[model samples]
Target chain A: MSIELEIQLVAVVVSVACSLAGVFLVLRRMALMSDAISHTVLLGIVLVFFITRDIASPFLVLGAAAMGVATVGLVEALVRTRLVREDASIGLVFPALFSIAVILITRYAGSVHLDTDAVLLGEIAFAPFRRLEVGGVDLGPRSLWVMGGVLLLNITFIALLYKELKLSTFDPGLAAALGFAPGLLHYAFMTLVSITAVGAFDAVGSILVVALMITPPATAYLLSDSLPRVLILSAVIAALAALVGFWTAWLVDASIAGCMASAAGVLFLLAFLLAPERGVIAVARRRSRQRWEFARLMLAIHLLHHEGAPDAANESRETHLGEHLRWEPKFARRVVSEAADEDLLVRLQDGRLELTETGRDSARKAMLV
Target chain B: MNPLRDLLFDYTLRTVALGAGTLGIVAGALGTYAVLRRQSLLGDAISHAALPGIVLAFILTGMKSTLVLVLGAALAGWLGTLVVMMIVRHSRLPEDSALGIVLSVFFGAGLVLLTYVQKLPDASQAGLDSFLFGQAATMLERDVVVIAVLGAIALLAVVVFWKEFKILSFDPEFGASLGMPMRSIDILLTTFLVIAIVIGLQTVGVVLMSAMVIAPAAAARQWTNSLSVMVLLSALFGAMAGVTGALISSTAQHVPTGPTIVLCATVLVLISMAFAPERGLIWAAVQRRQQRRQIRADAVLGDLYALAGHHESEHAHDVTVLEAMRAGRTDVHRALDILEERGLARRDGTGGWTITRAGRAEAEQAGESGPDGQHEREGSA
Candidate 1:
């Protein structure tokens, strides 16, 4: 495969794996945990490299995953103290660990080629150079193989534990009562998140890992309510973002991971503005429609209230609709006309308004509710 | 003494350390409020969001002055926060999700701009990436002056609105009932926080700036309960970390000043959590242990008091009978030895213990103190 193809493949696999875990993270309200994990995992890799003196050790992955879990664990411990909140705990844990890693790199491992810059802005372009070979057969880019394996692991975990994950995410108490052990499931899921973050770290870097993980799942969440649909939509969105981000990077010759993240963000914004049910436009339309219906109900109720009272004629006159109801003339006219068209009001021969039987029944029901 | 004077008065080191110290104090003061309001992550978001603004400012003006870049960063941070507020108000997403989204998206945009700028014709643009990880060693006297000025403004704002900001952090509803402009106070506080984050960008950088804002305040929180004391201590701790980290990093080879300062702050946090007088873990553990010992002594004293009720002549109780009174306790002898040491009881040389005159007085004290024991347990730790 071409190097460009390999980069895109790596991006796709990384995004899909991250988004899959991102779905659960967003659902469980642990979106920032990925950010924390992505950062502190740098410390893990550095520590492991110091021990093995080689960057190609599998111990690095193991160490990164361990550090990810350690980050979550330490944050939880701090939060449990009730002295600090979750967000503050997160902010405290990762920076301390990441800074330690950075300091260690500058102090002990300066002779090594472990640059902090690479951890932040990963050179996916270099992925093509780090070829994976097995039995003298070239297996394309190493990042592609590593990310592909991680993707398979994620798919297998999600598929096998779909129901458990859904139940735990939606309602943990019920899951626990059903013997699912939500706490155990949570940590297990975090471990998977850590592993996936490690795999994506080299391809997209840490911050973009967070962007790809969160943005796609969040957009998918805005688009769908069902867990299945959300999962599927998130993967599709991530894949599309990967492809588009690659092309944009190619066009602009900028940071490929950054462009991919930008593409994912763009997709999220589009969904935010245009999703069918939950989009901003849809919400505004529904609210305004409800307001109009409410005004019409008020008109019906007002006429019903003055049906036989003294000064009922003056109050019910269409000309007095704005004055008595305290509405704008145009607004009053619109409500009255719409009500008439809906057969909820009638113009009396004496030049006063009255509610039809259906209108009166509906008005009483609205008031009762 | 010569070495100390040289370290303190050295021009280059003094500039870097003084600049970091100023940034530390401002961030510390503002961070106390941020941590109290549970808006600590807001600092993180604003710092990341400031990146695009920083890049855009360089692109627009092509000037790398501290003031221009800081102004750009403050504007960007403020705009990002405004967007965050808008998202929270208008969307279904929660605050953390909104914060994460704005933070990542803006930083990505900044990265895109940064890469573009790196390829531009101007070599001065190369310094822009340093704003990410920070290069405290390169701070100029002019940069120090900028930080000092901005830091003074933020500090002045905090002092001028102390009562109002305090009430806003603790209770906005009450402040509103007093006819104060709650919204304006909120905006003013956020503006100060943004300035605080922006000023530190040159030294701590965007990635670790939030740590500077958070760690000092958090470490100070472990030592005090009053807001005023917390703020003061936070500023002190921040300045200490700043000066110490800068000094150490300058002396050490290859160590970056930002992370070293953060590491120093973390060290303070660890020490405070473990050993602070009132709220520290060691204190809590010690208090728990002492309470357990006092309860055991009281039980044994009470047991002896009961055994004395059946005595006619000597008021001596057998050890076996005392053990039977508090059944299943293997530590009964040890309890007796503690009481004996306190002059509350004495061994009668026949595997029995006699309650002394002082022991009888203490038993009565323990008898009358039963209800207060509940209060003491409630108040101890």
Candidate 2:
């Protein structure tokens, strides 16, 4: 495969792995936890790197995973103190940890190749050069293999614990009572996410990790109701975004990660506006339809109630709706005309409105219900 | 030494410190509102989102002036915030995910622009990425002046719209009922935050700037419950952190000023949480310890008082029922020792204890203090 194709594969694999975790994260209202973990995991890598002085020793993954769990635990501890709110706690912890890592890099190991910019901004174009070797046999890009393994791990984990994770995410109290240990499951999942983030960090950068993880899953959430569909849909969306982002990067001669993130944003915006049930336009249309239906019924009910009253003539006048219902003059006129058009109500020669039999029956039913 | 003179005497050091301090004050004052309003992470989103604006501004104007960059940043940050609000209002996606989306995507876009600009022939984008982790050491005198003027404007707006902003923060529904333009008021308040964020982008950089906003107000929150005092103390802490971080990074080798400022502000947060008189964790823990002991002592004393009513049962150890009250507790002996130490009970040579007149009086007072214990237990949860 060409370098471009390999780069696209890495982006797709990384995003798929991230979105799998992202699905659960979004449902748990802990999406920002991924954000916090991704940044803070750098501390673990930095700390472990100082001891080993080898960037590729594989200890860095352990370090990153540990710090991710540590970030969750520390944030929870601070929240337990009730001294700081959750957002403030996350805001406080990540930067403090990330800053320490940055300082360590700038101060103690300035000459090393552990560049902060690459970690955040990502360099997927260069992935083809970092080939994996097994017994001197040539393999493909290292990032592709690493991310593919992480993706496989994610799928297996999700498959094995689907029932438990779904139960815990939707209703934790029930999961806990059922002996699933939601808190323990949460920490375990976060730990895996940390490991995945460290693996993907080389391919997509930290912030883009968040973008791929959050935006795709969030868009899928809008497009589906069932959990299984949501997961599958998010993975597909992630793959599509990766492809589009890679192509855009090639077209613009820009950062691939950025292009991918921008693609995710554009896709989510489309979902936000055009989804079947939950999109803005759909909701707005539903709301307007409901308003008109209610207004028509209300007009019939008003006329029926005053049909035989002593002030019936005054109450049935077209002006009464604007006065009593407090609707705008234009809206009242439209509702009046629509009711007439539908034969729900008739306008008398004197400009009094009267409900027909069908209208009266419908109004009575609405009142009964 | 006069601190002001010493601080302002050096051109480079003074510019860096003043610039950071100004950013701190604006962010600190505005951040108090952000924290109180539970929009703390909005600062993070705005700061990160401002990068594209910075790069875009430099690209559009072909100038590297702080004002132009700040203007670009403010507009971009404002747009990012509006998008977040739009996403939350229009869709079921919660605010955090919306924040994450805008923050990352905008930063990604900014990096794309930054990379594009670097490839250009002008070379004016040389210092553009400095807004990433910040280069406080290279902050110019002109940047300081720009920051001060903007900081003054934000602070002034905070004062001018204090009442409306306060109502908007605490109870927007109530303000709207009273016919205040809550949405416009909210926009104004957030706009100030955006300005503060853009100003600080040149000092703390995009990644660590959120800490500058949160740490100060959070620290001050521990010190006071009053909004005015919290805002004031927050600004003070922010300024102090800014100056201190800038100074340390300048004096030391290999310390980045932005994170140093953040770490310094974090230390203040830690101190406030641990030691602040009203809400500090240590103080609460100590009070809880003392309260528990008081409740325990009261219970044991009341036990002695009630047990005293039984005939000739003045000696605690002699009473088998009191031993039954022990119920696997070595603390019973400890409580007895404490009572004896205070002369509330006397130890007989036969290894028994008797309640004194003082113990009886205190037990009567404890029984009278009904519901005090109830309130204390309720407060603990």
TM-score per prediction, in order, is 0.94, 0.91
TM-score of chain A, model number 2: 0.94
lDDT by residue for model 1 (A1-369), tens: 788888888889999999999999888888888889999999999999989999899999999999999999999999987667888899899989999998888788877778877888888879889988999998788888889999999999999999999999888989999999888888998999999999998888888889888889988988998999999999999999999989999999988888888899899889988998988988999999999999999999998888899989899987898788889888988998999999998988997888899999988998894
lDDT of 2 by residue, A89-172 (tens): 998899899989888888988899787787688878899998999999879998899899999999998999999999999999
How does the DockQ of candidate 1 come out? 0.66
Candidate 1 clash pair list = none
Off by over 4 Å in 1: A346-351, A356-358, B1-3, B176-179, B313-353, B356-381
lDDT tens digits by residue: candidate 1, B1-381: 243475678888888889989898999999999999988889998999999999999999999999999999999999989878877777777777778787888888888889999999998887798898788889999999999999999999999999999999999999999999998999899999999999999888898899888889998999999999999999999998888888888877788888888888889888888888878888878988766766676687788887787776366777788788778564678878888888988988676788888988877875677768645643652
User: How much of the real interface does each model capture, measured as fnat?
Assistant: 0.60, 0.82
Query: How many pairs collide in each candidate, listed in order?
Result: 0, 0
- Candidate 2 docking classification: medium
